[model samples]
Target: MSGLAAGWASGAQGRTARSPGIAVTIDDFDLTDTPLMSGEERDAAIRAALARHRVKAAGFVAGKYVGDSLDPAVLARWSDGGHILGNHSFSHRYFGGEDPAGFMADVLKCEPLLSGYAGFRRLFRFPYLAEGKIAAGRDTMRALLKRHGYRNAPVTIDTSDWYVDNRLKARLLADPRQSMEPYRRFYLGHVWERATFYDGLAQSLFGHSIDHTILLHHRLTTGLFLDDMLAMFEERGWRLVDADKALASPLLAREPEGLPAGQSLVWALAKADGRYEGRLRYPGEDGAYEAPRMDALGL
Candidate 1:
């Protein structure tokens, strides 16, 4: 086995005791208006929540969402608020079916906008968490990122916050005066469930908890309840770490030999281990998986 693979095998024997840690990483600086809030209002709300909690997050910028207009101001607020910004690709295309060369160009295209920010980092997150479907495409993209001095920002705790936000928006449009408590309840519960599950999976595979990066998006749900979400983690004894510190975990740098290359890093590592098949699910977290449950609950 390769050194990294061996290290993973050795750690899987027993669980190591440690406190859980997580950092918030928001994606897609989509400045489009939503049902409940205007684009600028949504941006202000998210930044306000972060400031209120004194938490520094990493916002991944999708070039397509940003333009010559008010978009730069929206991103400027994030950087000025002590948050880090990373590239999420210009077109935000799924790398799985994309040509490697084209995808690299897309990633490069987004860097200029972020470079002006003091908080910008040479971190790149795969759009949709889909790295590539084949080994060649994956390796090619990896080389491009490495060549550009960019590290792949792997998410460990993945949640479908965007999906929940969609549902909440739909509800609000149907009746703006309706109670938002149910949406809050569902969002918090969904996040906690994914957080614990991924944390447990990491513990089982690594024998300890690694600093986790939870995937969240810039949306109405997040803008409305990010403070609550951060508080929820703290109340549950999970340490809220900075995105820079969380992404610094050495484990996040290790490449798993799993095919179709990406999802949550923890999920990929578990797949490469070949022992957690029964507990694993393809496409780790998705709206489809939560739809029935949400529907059943009338959420």
Candidate 2:
């Protein structure tokens, strides 16, 4: 195991050890009605699912989505349900191509909207998971976050759940009575596959399983099947932990030396190490990668 990996596992023996654990971290709370449900209805369903599983998720909210058109109470629901709210920037700008001052200003702009929530935390997730394309840019942002007492929220198991949701919505719009079984199966299978792949990579790189945070979004797909997803993890011998607890893992705090700095944290670390080239992919997970597989299934 590498020194970085060793550091991640240093205090493991003292904790209540179990199988690899994961926490739910949702991003882009884009509140809009879809073919399947109204925005409010979707929010209720997602909250109910989380309540059913007793999971406290971290919701990363982008400020632009929280407008006068939508009720602010929709966001209060997350806080009421005991989930933490984090900043995902105001404009949801891609930081890799953004001017540093503008990006920093956008992040600061989103902070006020979240401050009122009892569950608010000074955790910031980069929109599109793009930190920056250069070392100086990445470090400048990092320094700003540090000075503001914000921790960069990193994703470990990144999935294309948004893509699956898009297809499912389109199918529903075409035929509301279409059997959802196929969509359910595909979503579950895709998530599990990515989970195992990342878990294996983490074990190989860290020589131990680090607590993971799976990147999901607030969408119809998550609202409908989050309960099933949580059950799947539990049945597979993985512990479902609180988002804050999972995020506290020391490994998440380590910044990789790679120039174009963000992806799944494990992927970025491996890229920095330069030994896992064959097993990694650039832009770790995206809709494009899943398009062909879904097309083959006619989904």
Candidate 3:
């Protein structure tokens, strides 16, 4: 059986009338400045929403921004509230674009900072999902991570908030009259595309559930829609696995699958029928969201 299939077999053996099939993960919890609140206040606002939903999810935080003490304090709260901390890399730079050694250093710096309070963080989501071209792709990243005992996250769905706010920003610049509605609407529109991308990814990759990880951003724009985000997870009947428990999967023991896939089916399905406004028409659309990628996103 494939490594993916082994997961199905284990789930089948443990199945009961009440067993569930999948789960979702959310991260990229970064915030700098905002119009409505200070950075700390915004963090509190987002945390308030998570607490209110009684939702437990993961936050792939920037180690330097939160600082060691702040990183652990916030992570512990999220973990206690039911969220896990994944690696966003200490710098949150585009890891795939950097020199092999330089990239590994920045990435590894995050863990020791977190380990100062939390111990080693085993799960890694490449900054920006930027796993470049194939042979060169998996060769450097997978090997470097293996050297440090980190697992590459298999992202089945991406909320793509990274593009949303950037697009929102340009809109405000080009057409200053455009109101906050655009940002609000894009934020609200993510849940549908999120599920579609996630489901499509499952069918393509594992042919079944297999603990899929869904990427989310803690960017303030994403915060606008977070209450709904958490509700989607709860309503879907999934629980956030503790990052520690999540890391223990054998999938992490080595490269879970081969390197840089040129196209994940989720992207194709998303292209044809994705309804999430954020992914549907990004930075080009009217919103504070910046950043646009025609090639990488295949839009």
lDDT of 3 by residue, 78-127 (tens): 65565566677887776443476777788778876555434335777776
Worst 10 residues of 3 by lDDT: 281-290
For each candidate in the order shown, give its overall lDDT on alpha carbons: 0.85, 0.85, 0.53
Query: Can you tell me which runs of candidate 1 are displaced by over 4 Å?
Result: 1-17, 68-70
What is the TM-score (0 to 1) of candidate 2?
Answer: 0.92
**Which runs in model 2 stand beyond 4 Å of their true positions?**
1-17
Return model 3's CA RMSD, one decimal: 8.8
Q: Over the stretch 1-299, how does candidate 2's per-residue lDDT look in tens digits?
A: 22432333322332225467989999989878887788888888888888888889999999999886457898798898889999999999888844787788899999999999999999999998899998888988998899889999999999899999999999898899988889999998888778877776787788767789999998988888888999888777788899999988888999997978899998888888889887787778888988998899999
- Measured with C-alpha atoms, the lDDT of residue 137 in candidate 2 is 88
What value does the lDDT take at residue 117 in candidate 2?
91
Model 3 quality (TM-score) = 0.65
User: Between 2 and 3, whose TM-score is larger?
Assistant: 2
The TM-scores of all predictions, comma-separated, are 0.92, 0.92, 0.65
